[model samples]
Target chain A: MLVLKPMMQKTSAKYFFLMPGVLWILAFTLFPLVYSLYLSFTDFRLGKEPQFVGTKNYVEILGLDGEGGDDKALETATFSLFLTLGSTSMTLIMGTLIAWVFNHDLPMLRQMRAIITMPLFAAPIALGFLGVVIFNETNGPLNNILQGLGFERIQWIIDPWGARFAVLITDTWQWTPFVFIVVLAAMQSIPEDLYESARLDTRSNWILFRRITFPLIAPALGTVALLRLVETIKILDIPISLTGGGPGAATQTYSYYVYQIGLRGSFQLGDASALSYLVVIIAIIISSIYFWRVRARFD
Target chain B: MDAASSLSSSIQTTHSKPGYLPGTSRIGRYLLIGLAFFFTFLAISPFLFALTTSFKTQTDSIDGTVIPFIQYQPTLINWEQEFGLGGTETFKSLRNSALIALGSTLIATILGTLAGYGLGRFKYGIGNRNLVSWFMSQRFLPPIASVIPFVLLFRDLKLIDTLPGMVIINATFTLPFAVLIMRDFFADFPQELIEAALVDGAGHFQTFRDIALPLATPALVASVIICFSFAWNEYLFASVLATKEWKPYPMLVAGSDSVRGIMFGFVTTRMLIAVTVPVFLSLLVQRYIVRGLTFGAVKG
Candidate 1:
């Protein structure tokens, strides 16, 4: 691996482009993350006069947080799970539905596709936070709808589940198109004959779907779900913007916990890094699972 | 959607009338249309409400009871304040956002185009796959992992909440996409063109500048639009990295700290401003998106 073969040696110009990217990622990305992991294990809260309290930070944040401690890990886990599950499932379902709509051959289909993808393109913090204002309980547009439907306007921001659902709805609205775009592309690539052959077996559209459509799109669907899972897990802005993971940590995702600990509320840099390291480890594992499946498919 | 689906259904029938019942096909079509309507509604409701809410007066926004389709008056009060005709915080945010997005996108494009060319023409063996995948993975690296790190890094560097800071962070993410897209376009080019330039005694840089650059115009335009829109719409990194005074446009609207049910006119105006640039850019590049998608697998 250390030996530079002759072919590699001649590539001075090529190395220039690739190296900068590698170095940039290393400096701002790989090194920082690794540093964060190291810090996670230390007693590194701001103004605490720092110490090497090995594994104390991790244990504390992971729920064995000793008495009178924050119990942050326990608080964080429930909310993160709810958040991850809610956002992921909603995006997957909506994404597939939208893809099916966009898959049909139509003039301006591409334009519509781009329009659908617009939400994801919009910065999450801005659009997502703005959505919070729009969905506000007292004067939120959603309550207006609820009221109009012959029901009482309910508390949106006040309830943990309601806020969580609002975050999910907005995220789904934004990201469904991502899955849609990829799935539509996969659907387009599918051999038409496969669908036609399914048609030969039955005229029932349910049969056509059960036997043909769903199975064929499974890989794409799975890929999108996996991608959404990894992306959704890191979400900080949307939940933070909408609910502050509020109504008592109902929406506080693990990533948001990292923010709460590291920067904004507490400034517990060491604890935050530890929490983030835990989050990264989980993300890595999830991504590995996705890649492992993808590899198996190719093999 | 219904009209197109029906026509396509007829075409499907013509290709070969399947053994299915006629009633079920129609029902299937209706179900699909219903689902499509629900999806489209879900997709556009945010925009629609944002549009309507932008026009609502302070009273109406606080009341928050504006009904859809029927009932309720739409006002232009919010829009006015946002445009500064009504005198509000709207214009300031918009201006800050535009400067940062434009500044970052331009820098990212230049660096990326060069990097793309380098990757395309030069061949290297060791760590190539890992390197390429690493670049792609960075695209999906989940913003959460990097946001905190960047906040700490930028603060120490004293670049927080500034346009230059936002531009640099925005450029890193854009760099990978720009390189990947441009590199693929380069890979598709015939080597003969470059060889001929070399035979004509042009130096490597000159060959790339005169020959390759002109030919990659479509790709350049596409990648530029993509990088620009991404920078324009960037929310998370900018939110953490830049505060309001130096806030990028998207951060202004999607701020995590917005006071609940505040200004109606201001909100609408910001929404319009936040959405306008990227929407316009996407429309301009709409023609190239499908072709550009192939960049994922095939390299130039």
Candidate 2:
């Protein structure tokens, strides 16, 4: 068998197989990433010859320029951070609670699970449009029900806080099911023996959940939260569709602000690139903490 | 016999649990079921409202009635406008989306499967772990950071607003996911089958083609569906890279908001059409989603 084997070296063959994909990543992903980083240092506006500006864009964006700094960029970063924390926390709590309820064997459980997760499949752009209709103050069902219940109808899209709330609600709605599905799957994977022994000791559901379920599911929840954090920071479609970054710049997330600068507005490609690098830095910091905490379990 | 006894004992222990005590637990279970139904309703209500409103005429959609078909007679006008003879732009956008999604998915799956097979089966000086991690780190690069370069690069290549260009970008974005999922699938597969094929004098390619490929049908389907959904739902690249000639369905739906100004009927109609295929496919492959979304880090 050894004598009959082909003479091709397995190591080289593996490299041969990996060549196309590696090249694709190098050309499209790595090359572009490096180019963007280089562009961040230059005055690379659309339709103009690039000139090396040497940190001016970064300085301006960071508010370190002698000129009173970019207030809107700071505001956008704050809003993105706010939205990330708010949405990720809400999604995790609601999803875990709902998953606990769903961990039970019940009639029509399969179909119910399917219905709950349906929004996770909807395009975010489409969900944004749905938000427009559902959160419409005048004729939307939400305000209509509010009025029907003898309460004054609140302006959902017009008021600033109202607009922010609408975006948050829509974000939570679209993503909670994601957290729910993953957490539910995690819960189901817990060994039945752990639960059985815990129940043998105590009839308190809370105690069993705290002692056994929460610890067991902590790693999975951490994974889900980290993923959601990265995703929520890049939220663009929902806010764009919901309020177009609002009556003011109330809902302009960091990515949305970058989109406005780079693509839609002044076409400040250099500044946008610098701003994006900042966003990536923030994401790396946050994810590093999460990974460091969870490293022990995986090892 | 030992396994059977353990299983029976586990069942006995479960049944004898104090938590299962009579009417109290039964009532608790009912309450839990009620809560599940409520949350499910909340989850589905927005889309349901959109669906019902899609069937309403423009006037009826804004009638301020929560009830559909009862508060007003449902009409087919919206659906007609979406699929009718005059709906060329909408139809064209849908076609563009389908073509881009299908094209990218096919390319991603093929490239990803080959690379995944190498990483999963072959041991080398560099090791597959480093390579796999490098592939996954691509996803962490925010889209905003790359969209400008892509726009410029695509323009230089004269590939802007073209289906193939969009396909290339989409495939690049989805390739990490596809590679990770397929690699895990191949890693989890039994090695004996490949060994047996090797003993029969099959080369690496021959073994992959005749033995490994056939057994990987489930993973292939999962990867294809996942890649399709990512490409289909993609908006940022599509928005920037593709202009009118190849504007995808998401762009069209977003365009309608500004161009048509809350034409609830048309917006809902376009949205329903845009989401139908991906949503249906996702439900079918729901079990595989956790694995794909997490880059095969956690099993569903």
Candidate 3:
């Protein structure tokens, strides 16, 4: 009896320690998640009684069962995909190149690296605001520089393609620093002997980098790419702040689209809820692929 | 004689390796240095431009000049107008943002620390790996998915437009990150100190407060800064949940576009104010941030 008493007490004590956090997660996270799932099945909106629709919302969104799905959802998914690919690749490439440069001995390297990463620290919304100032048609610096160089001012914000480019630029500017810092840390960890031994064989910096540095940093780069994929698809703030998904929904991302449908436009909670579930499914698929790839590497 | 000469050569090579410069021409080195400087300048140019423009008058900000200080006198009209005595809306929003951020950060840190300790130290039938992974997977759920339910739930509870509402929601999202970070930190904590404290008959809470909490200060600091910045920078929930009474600073900055043809000076000033604390905090704990950001996937 006494032996069992201590074990029970220990178990209870652990639960006691875990109670607050678990309860917080339960009430705020799990409950809301379950509630959202329920809401997705019902035609619910603000100030309206929810009716059980039985897969109608999902069907409409997916275009399954011979019904035309929501075009907005498709558009949002396409935009998210494009932005994810564009920004992630750009950030990865630019960041790795810059990290490679910084890996060399340079004066004021620490200060310069810090300055380069400052953009990552700024809020996405703030970056969006800065995007506005930087991409301004006439008074902005980019246009001013163009004019100074005898070039015509491009309509950066008003035109559709220009607005999309502006959003991509802002996203790239904010996230490249993240990749830079991560890759730089990974690069710094490689033993100097590896580089020296490779250097003894070849005077070509390109060959040395390709053989020694690239292979060493590939794992870190993969991790960053996976993380970036998840984050970029769910991006909301930059699009909201910079272009407001403007020039007629040219830059509307997945989250922004969900926000618009769920909260802003007509308050279609059922459709929005279903839309969010679709997003969750896409996210899960991506994450599972990442996990599979990572596990394969380890094996 | 052959053995001694080889050993001496090996030592000399090792010594020279530390001071060895990679083979690059002087011009190439100079070019690389220039490129680094150029990129650095490019990264910070937005901030510098914003800072200079924040000091410009309405007319001066719109003038066709690239340089603010060179073209016209710098003025404090925007700052004075927004942050000075008359800017009640701006001040209120700032205060609300601070309250929500600090409140949520404190809650997330304490809860996460306790949960992390429990998950790290105890064994359970469900398994700690399962629990920890469950907590982390919550982060992967698109926030908009949960946000829809949160909007409805808050509306029913009359939590919309309330400071506590914002705090609760922020802590909810930030909790997963906090738990993941704190869990990793606790898992890495030296076992001997904890063992000694327990062997001396210290209770679990006492051991946590006296032994574990003190040692986990770096992680705690990282958690607090991350939580605060996230809660502060969050806009979606803040926009929906809080209205005129409890609007956050981000909402104020976002809503500024409505005030007549993109007021550059006003917008820039608000943006600078919004970003200053997070940027400063990030710079201070630059090393620890990667762990918090990556959820311990990539150690700093």
Candidate 4:
């Protein structure tokens, strides 16, 4: 009885500690999640009872109804894909380059690293506002510098492609440092002894990097790439502030489109909820692949 | 040669293995440094331009003024308008931001620490790995997925546009991150101390409150800084949930435009105000920022 009592106390004590967090998640996160899923099936609107429509929202969104229902979702999904691919590629390439540069034992490189990473911490929406100033077509410094360098000025904010480019630049600038920091850490973690042993066989630094550094850091790069891919798909704030989904919906990302449908302009809560689930599902699939692939690496 | 000298020489060779580029000359090193500095400038150029814009007249900013006193005259009009004693709106948002951020951070850190400690130390029949994954999956769930439910739920509870409402949502958003970090921290904690305390008759909570919590300061600090910064920088929920009374600084920054198509000078100041906390906190938590960001996948 005494031994059982102590075991019971220990077991209950663990639950006691976990109780608050579990309950909080139940009420705030899990409940709302299920509720939103419920809302997705209904024609939910503010001040109107959510009438269950039975897969109508999903069908219209998926165009299973055959009338090209919600073609806008397709358009926005395409834009989201473009932005995701563009931003992820640019961020990965630039981040790897910068991290490689900063990995060296150079003067003030640490300080340079610190300075470069500042953008990662800034709010994306705030960066979007800053992007407006930076990408200002007429008098923006970017175009000013281009013209000064004898290149034709690019219409950064007004044109569709230009606005898309601006969003890519802003998201890349903000997230590149994330890759930089993570990759830099990965690079630094490589034991010098590996290089020491490799140096016996090769004097070519390129070969050394290819043979020794690249393979070791490939996992880190892969992880950063996956993280960036997931994040860029949900790009909303930058488009909201930088382009306002302007230039005829050129910059309208999937999330921004979902926001418009759910919250703004007639408040189509059901459709928005349905759209949100699609994104959630996509994100889950991406991360699940990532986790499954990397599960062997983790304990 | 002595073994220590050989070891030191090997270390020196590793240290001197020139940068990514194959360069041994002093000129090459300096050139690499310069290139690095240029990239650094490119990274921070947005903030730099914004800082200059914050100090410039509206006309000066739109004129693409790059250098202060060279291309255009700078002024404090923007700052005076947004942050001077008369800027009640900005002040209210700042206050609301601090209160909401701090309130949410407090809740997330405390609750997360307790749960994280349990998850870290105890083995459960359900599996800690599964529980931790469940916690972390919440972090990746699209905010849009929950915003509707939150709006409807908060409306019924009279929580929309309230400080507590913002705090609750922000805390919920940041809780998963907090758990991931603190769980990793406690998992790596020294088991001897915990075992000793248990042998000495300290209850689980007692050992946690005294031994684990105090020793877990660095992780706690990292979690707190991360949670606060995330809560502070939040905008989507702020824009939707907070109409006027609980408007956060990000909304103020985002909404800083007039009929003149995005008042560049005013918006710059608002952005600077919005980013200062995060920029400073990032520096303070630089060591743990990577870990916190990657949800403890990286032990950095």
Maximum-TM-score candidate: 4
Query: Worst 10-residue stretch by lDDT in candidate 1 chain B?
Result: B13-22
lDDT of 3 by residue, A54-162 (tens): 8999988889967778888788788889999999999999999998888887887756776787787677887798788889997888889898899999898899889
Candidate 1 lDDT tens digits, A1-299: 44565335336656655666667667766766776666767776666755778888766654465555456666776677776787778777767666665555444454455556566556666566667667777777777788889898767778767777877777777777666767666666666677666666777756766776688778767767777787777777677666768888887877777676677777778777777777677777786666555432111
DockQ of each: 0.33, 0.51, 0.48, 0.55
Better of 1 and 2 by TM-score: 2
Locate the minimum summed-lDDT window of 10 residues in model 2 chain B: B13-22
Error of 2 at B247 (Å): 1.0
Error of 3 at B268 (Å): 1.1
lDDT of 4 at A15: 97
Per-candidate TM-scores read 0.83, 0.93, 0.92, 0.94
Estimate the lDDT of model 2: 0.82
Writing each residue's lDDT as its tens digit, candidate 3 over B106-215 gives: 89988998888887777757767667666766777778888888988998999999988999999988997788778877887787998898779787778889999987
- What order do you get sorting by lDDT, best first? 4, 2, 3, 1
Q: What is the lDDT, from 0 to 100, of the residue B97 in candidate 2?
A: 92
Task: Please report the candidate that would top lDDT against the real structure.
Answer: 4
Ranking by DockQ: 4, 2, 3, 1
lDDT of 2 at B230: 79
- Position A36, candidate 1: lDDT: 68
**CAPRI quality band, candidate 3:** acceptable
State which docking tier applies to candidate 4.
medium
